[model samples]
Target: MSLQFDIDAVLDRLATDGWVVIPHAMPAALTAELRDACLQVWQQGLFHEAATGRGDGQARRAEIRSDSVLWLDKVATLPAVAAYNAAMDDIMQAVNRGLYLGLAELESHFAVYPEGAFYKKHLDRFRDDDARTLTTVFYLNEAWPQDAGGEIRLYLDADCTQHIDVTPEAGTLVLFLSDRFWHEVLPATQQRLSVTGWYRRRGGSVPW
Candidate 1:
C-alpha cells in the first residue's frame, strides 16, 4: 500500500490550524482493500453498537452516537488492516519529529454509521482522562455525494458558533487535536464508513 500525502504539509496545517483534511491520502487500491475488509467483518456481525465513555462509565447511548464499531486491535492480522497500521506508524513518527507531541501509539476502529445515524457534538478526550492527544479519521466510501448528509461538522470555536462540514469521501484523511475540537457526525441517507482512531501519549488509557 502506498501513502501519497505530504507529511510536512499536513504537520504545518496541524500546527497552525489544529486540524487538517487531506483528500486522496491513500492509494485507491489500498483504500478499496481496507473498505472491503471493514465491510466483510461487519457483515459477519463483528461490529457492536458503539458506546459513550470508557471502562465502567461506558454504555450504549443511541441518542449520543448511533454507529457500530469494530476495534482494529481485534483484527490486526488482516492484510488491509496491517497495511493501514504500518502507514499510521509512519505518520506517527513523522508527527513526533515535526511537532514533538510525544504521541506513543494509536488505537483505531472501523466505525460504520447506518442510515439515519449520527453522533452528537463532543470532544475526543474524556472528561477525567486526557491521554488522547490526536484524532484521525479515514473515510472509505467511494462516490459519496454532497447530499448524502454524512458530513463531519468540526466546530472552530469552543462555543461552537463557527464550524466547517466535511463530506465522507473515499481515501480522505482528517487529523486534529483531540482535546481542541468539538465535532459531530450528521445523519446520512446511506451507510457511512470510516476508520476512526486516536494517538495517545505514554501512560494514557489503552485503546481497547
Candidate 2:
C-alpha cells in the first residue's frame, strides 16, 4: 500500500507524543541515492567518531559533520530528494504555524553506526539557544531489523527516564521538537545508515 503524508495529523501527534513517524515520505529510488551518497562520504574517510559524554557508563558511537547546504543542494537537484524536501517544507511550515516564512535553510548529514556503535541519551536542541525548533531523521536501510538495535529512544522526562523506542526504517521519516525532546541511539548489530538534520528559524543559531 502507498503511504500518505498528513502534516496536520503528524503535528498533532508530535505535540501529544513528543514524536511522530511518517512512513514513505521519500521514494525508494531517492532513498537509495541518498544512502549511496552518505556511504561515499563514509568511504572517503570524511566522517569521525561522534562524541559521547552525557551517558552513565553506556557504550555508544556517532560521527557528525555540518555545512550541509552544499550536500543538500546536490541532493535536491535529484527529483526524488527535491520532491521529498518540498513535502517536508510544507509539513514544517504547518508545524511552526507558518513562522517558517521565506526560504528554509536545510542542514543534512550522514550518520553511520557499525556493530556495537550507539549514541547515548541526549537532546538535539542547545541549552542556551532555541533556534532549532524541528528535527528530522530519514532512515536509509532497506530492511532494518528490530533486533539489530540502533533504535532511537526518546525520554519523556527531564531525568532521561520513561520513553519510547523507535526502529530505524528505510523510507521512514521521523520528526520531533528538537529543544524539548531527549533521545538516544542504541548500538547496532550491523551497519545503520541515515540522514539526520533540522529545520531552524534562522536566529540564535548554534553550530553543531
Candidate 3:
C-alpha cells in the first residue's frame, strides 16, 4: 500500500515550527514488511557500527554513538523498500514545491539501536557540507511501550534550554531542517528500529 500524509499540514508545520512529526505516515502493512526486511538484514549481521564525520574525519566513536546501520540502495529490489523510496520521493517533491527547498535526492539507512545504546546531540548537517537540507526518520517498532526508552530528543533552542522527546513508534515519520536542529537519541532499554535519511540539494557538498 502507498504511504499517506497531509502535505499542507506538514508544510505549514515546517514553516511555523521547523519540524513536524506525523503518526501513521505509512500504512501498517508496509511498516510490517519493512520491519521484516530490516530484521532479516540485521540477523544476517549486515549492519556496521555507525560512525561520525565524513571521509578522513570519519571514525567510530562509541562514546558518542552506539547504534548500527545498513544503508538502503537508491533503487531497491525489495518491494517494501521500493515502496518506501517512492513515498520519500513524493515527500521530497511536495517539500520542494511548497518551500522551494530545491531538494534533489535522498540517502537513507536502516538503523538499529541495541539495548542501552544512544547517540549524543548533534546537527544532521556537517560543518563543512551543506548539501543535506532536510532530515527524515521513520520508525518501525510496533507497539512501542512507554518505557522503551529510545526517544529522539530535539533541542529547541540554541542554548539547549527547551526540547521535546519523540517516541519511536511504528508508522511514524519525523521531519526537520537538517541544519537547524540539535538532536540525540536517548538510550534504549530494548532494541530500537528505524529508517533514517536526509534529502539533499543539487550542489552544496558530496554525501558521506
Best by lDDT: 1
Candidate 3: tens digits of C-alpha lDDT, residues 45-142? 98999999998899999999999999999327889999999989999999999999999999999999999999999999988899998999999999
Better of 1 and 2 by TM-score: 1
lDDT of the candidates, in the order given: 0.94, 0.68, 0.93
Across 1-208, the per-residue lDDT of candidate 1 in tens digits comes to 3459888999999999999999998889889999999999999999999999988999999989999999999999999999999999989999999999999989999999999999999999997778899999999999999899999999999899999999999999999999999999999999999999999877765543
Runs of candidate 2 exceeding 4 Å displacement: 1-4, 51-84, 98-104, 205-208
Residue ranges of candidate 3 with Cα displaced over 4 Å: 1-3, 206-208
Could you tell me the lDDT of residue 181 within candidate 3? Answer: 91
Error of 2 at 187 (Å): 0.3
> How close is every model to the real structure, measured as TM-score?
0.97, 0.76, 0.96
Task: Give candidate 2's error at residue 129 in angstroms.
Answer: 2.6
The lDDT ranking, best first, is 1, 3, 2
Instruction: Please provide, for model 2 over 1-208, each residue's C-alpha lDDT reduced to its tens digit, 9 standing for 90 to 100.
Output: 1235766677678767767878887768778877777777677776756543323432234343211212455445655556656766666667667333232555656678777767666778665555667788889898888788878887877777788887888988888778778887877888888877777766554543
- At residue 149, candidate 1 shows an lDDT of 97
